[model samples]
Target: MKQYKLDFNSPIGIIEIVGSDTEVYSIMFSEHDQIVNVPQKDTPQVIIDCQQQLHEYFIGKRHEFTFSYTFEGTSFQKEVWTALTSVAYGETATYKKIAASIGNEQAVRAVGSANGKNHLSIVIPCHRIIGSNGTLTGYAGGMWRKEWLLQHEKWNSKGIKK
Candidate 1:
């Protein structure tokens, strides 16, 4: 498969969007030195759309993403990721909740593991999962970024911009 990459400057940090012409593969936070800005003309349309949607999200101008993406993971992980998408835009779920949603309530830890492996980041909304006690938990992008996302969604839910 032909893969394309692009780096986007977001409020939280630099993000790397990777995809093919027809489908997004992953979106991840890039280290300061890892980002390379690809000119718009050279980027695939899907990646450009992902970048634009991300920009809208950061600015609170968009709440939902409309793009095709392909998941590369175990079946169980894909199941967990699909469930993650069902989590409301401005709402949250616990790992336990996600496990239960997948009909494996006892697999909370496994659910967390699958979530940790998610590559789609904001598009998958893994940041929407919190601890059962309503406390924030692990986020690949750092807890501070997770907090920022949760707070951003919270503010957006209330029709207020932060």
Candidate 2:
């Protein structure tokens, strides 16, 4: 499958948005400084939509995204990612809770591993998962981004602008 890519300057940093004609494949942070200037008319509709929604999200205007996404991972990882989506906009769940939700209470560490493997970042809400002790845990985007997202959601949930 041919994949299209674009770099978006987000509040946190540069985000590399890669997708196909039908669905987004991944949204990951990028350290590279080169920004592709894909004209709006030339850019894929899915990519355009994803960037717009992400912009809205960063500004606390959007609470949920409507763009379709394709997940690439093992069955267990996919299941874990799906469960991560159920975590509400502001609410969070522990790794243990996610494991139990997937009918594998013993897979707490496995769930954490799968969470770290998630490539969709904020769209998948993997940052909403934390350690069972209520402390922030690993985020592929880094702990600071995770903390910012959680705080963003918390303020947004309360109808307060942040």
Candidate 3:
């Protein structure tokens, strides 16, 4: 399937949303040092909807995303991603917790690896994953963005405006 793309100007920076007409594939930040892809004029409706949802999320008007997205990764990664959604908007979970949630308490490192492979950014809620010791860990979109997202959700969940 041919994928379409759109660029959304978010509070943190420009977000590149890629998807087909039916489901989103990726939503990542367009790093300043990288060449940003020009958005297609005929952007997919699902992607447009994702843009709207993300905008609402950034503004604290939305907590959950209802956009259609496909997990284009291994089954293990998909399982990890599914468990990630349960981490909740403001709550955080550790890799060990995620592993346990999936009935594999010893796969904490694997859970972390799967989290690193997530491509949907905030929609997947991987940023909500913290270290077992309650410290922030690795995030594919950079640790700073992960920190920002956690803080964003923490404030929004409390009905506190950022």
Residue ranges of candidate 1 with Cα displaced over 4 Å: 33-35, 160-162
**TM-score per candidate, chains pooled:** 0.94, 0.94, 0.92
lDDT of 3 by residue, 30-116 (tens): 875443565467777788899899989998888888889988988899999999999878999999999999999999999999999
**Count of backbone clashes, every candidate in sequence:** 0, 0, 0
Q: After superposition, how far is residue 62 of candidate 1 from its true place, in Å?
A: 1.1
Best by lDDT: 1
Instruction: Identify the leading candidate in terms of TM-score.
Output: 1
Better lDDT candidate (1, 2): 1
User: For model 3, what is the C-alpha lDDT against the true structure?
Assistant: 0.88
Report, for every candidate in turn, its global Cα lDDT versus the true structure. Answer: 0.90, 0.89, 0.88
Ranking by TM-score: 1, 2, 3
* CA error at residue 146 for candidate 3, angstroms: 1.1
lDDT (Cα, tens digit) per residue for candidate 1, span 35-101: 5867467677788889899999998888888988988999999999999999987899999999999
Candidate 2 worst ten-residue window by lDDT: 33-42
Worst 10 contiguous positions by lDDT, candidate 3 = 31-40
Give model 2's TM-score versus the native structure. Answer: 0.94
For candidate 2, the lDDT comes to 0.89
